[model samples]
Target: MSRVSNMVAEFVATFPTTLRPGVLYVSGAYSTAAHLCCCGCGHEVITPLSRAQWVLTFDGTVSLRPSIGNWTLPCRSHYFIDSGSIRWARRYSEPEIEANREHDRQLLADARIDTPGGRHPLIQYCRSVWRRLRRL
Candidate 1:
């Protein structure tokens, strides 16, 4: 039954792959006027309002705006996922999210006063994210 066992193992591994969320990465590095959002902890910061959702499937279909549409950023205090399907803020590690926070700050700084490269850098970054998502 070695063959059977191998097949079962493969199937089990592929199961989660089939259900894996198509979103590869999201850029939480944007700025908007709606920054002050009540963190469940009662604090707030300048965070993105929401973001579009792109769904990549194992079947080779990239849905930019799926039936569910894009996700929502619950203020600058939470991370929106699956195009508003899921909202999370405390789910991520403090350190890693700090990096996202810094990145967002830099993006705002660049986008604000039309710094050097201007918004081109932010667009490039989002484009890079799109490309990476397509690969999966």
Candidate 2:
């Protein structure tokens, strides 16, 4: 698909109810970034900020280190967000995907953050519980 070449970053305290395509919503308060799939697929990609995952660099423009690979998504788009520009990357095969997964696993192990989506399992669980309690 002919994808959009550029993306706009918006700072938000909290993610909105929905994400707009090509608009990267960066929330420093949450240390997270969210956006629609750049490959024209409407999947919401939530990239958590962490040592084992993406490292966001924002200076007017934004760059997310370690290109994003949507292995779980059907589109499986791979690209680098460089200075608010979308740099499309070559598609990875299943074997390559497995290798990438292994690399990610090693990074997670080294960082001792073994939860899914690069988040601490206990922390997320506790946060969820607290949110639930707040709702009560």
Candidate 3:
């Protein structure tokens, strides 16, 4: 499983929903943008809307856009597949999610907020929840 896939799985598990078939699409992870990154492990991160399972699909696609997020990172090694190579898909197990959570936590802690895609949405969401809970 790829590191990004695992991190995405943890994000899904943390935020559960009833939507089904949620597909996780990853674009270029080696762009000159912000803090985005590519695992370069020949895997794409995908998660269905049903459960907390984040799958590493090999048959996937990468979209590099400056509007939303930094698709890729500055590191060349992060570029796993070609620009438009659809990869495979596999469900990430529970254990994988846990491991990824820890890793992601560390990543978030050290991430730069100035970067366009450096701040993970999950981290911001979690911070909002914490603030709300504090208010309550």
Candidate 4:
């Protein structure tokens, strides 16, 4: 796929229902960043902001961490969004894709386990119920 050289960043409170190619729409209020597929496939890509997910960095230009891999798309494009440029990454093999997917799943699980405040909601609820039963 051809590299996208002319990307522009826009900040909005709410993302537009319709996305336009070549524009990265960022919404800190909503904690999301979106853009059309740089592969010119016309697919809308929305990256949610989270510690375990994509992080948008803006320093006069916009960049996204961990790259965007359109694995489910027909195009299956993989690239990095950095400084208003789309740097194409080499296509991954099936095994590589599966490994990456597993890595992402593990990362999410770790994040949930390591949440700052306390144990995960389910674990906390279980412990609370156990304490109440013991008190009874």
lDDT scores of the candidates, listed in order: 0.31, 0.79, 0.31, 0.77
TM-scores, all candidates, are: 0.27, 0.78, 0.26, 0.79
Error of 2 at 22 (Å): 1.3
For 1-43, candidate 2 gives per-residue lDDT tens digits of 3366788888776899988788888765566789989998888
Residue-by-residue lDDT tens digits, candidate 4, 76-103? 9999988888898999999999999999
Candidate 2, run of 10 with poorest lDDT: 121-130
What local lDDT score does residue 127 receive in model 2, on the 0 to 100 scale? 47
Candidate 2 regions with alpha-carbon error over 4 angstroms: 113-136
Error of 1 at 132 (Å): 35
RMSD (Cα, Å) of model 4:
11.3
**Clash pairs, model 2 backbone:** none
**Candidate 1, 32-97: lDDT as tens digits:** 212122233322222232232122222232212222211134333334333223333354456766
lDDT (Cα) of model 2: 0.79
The lDDT leader among the candidates is 2
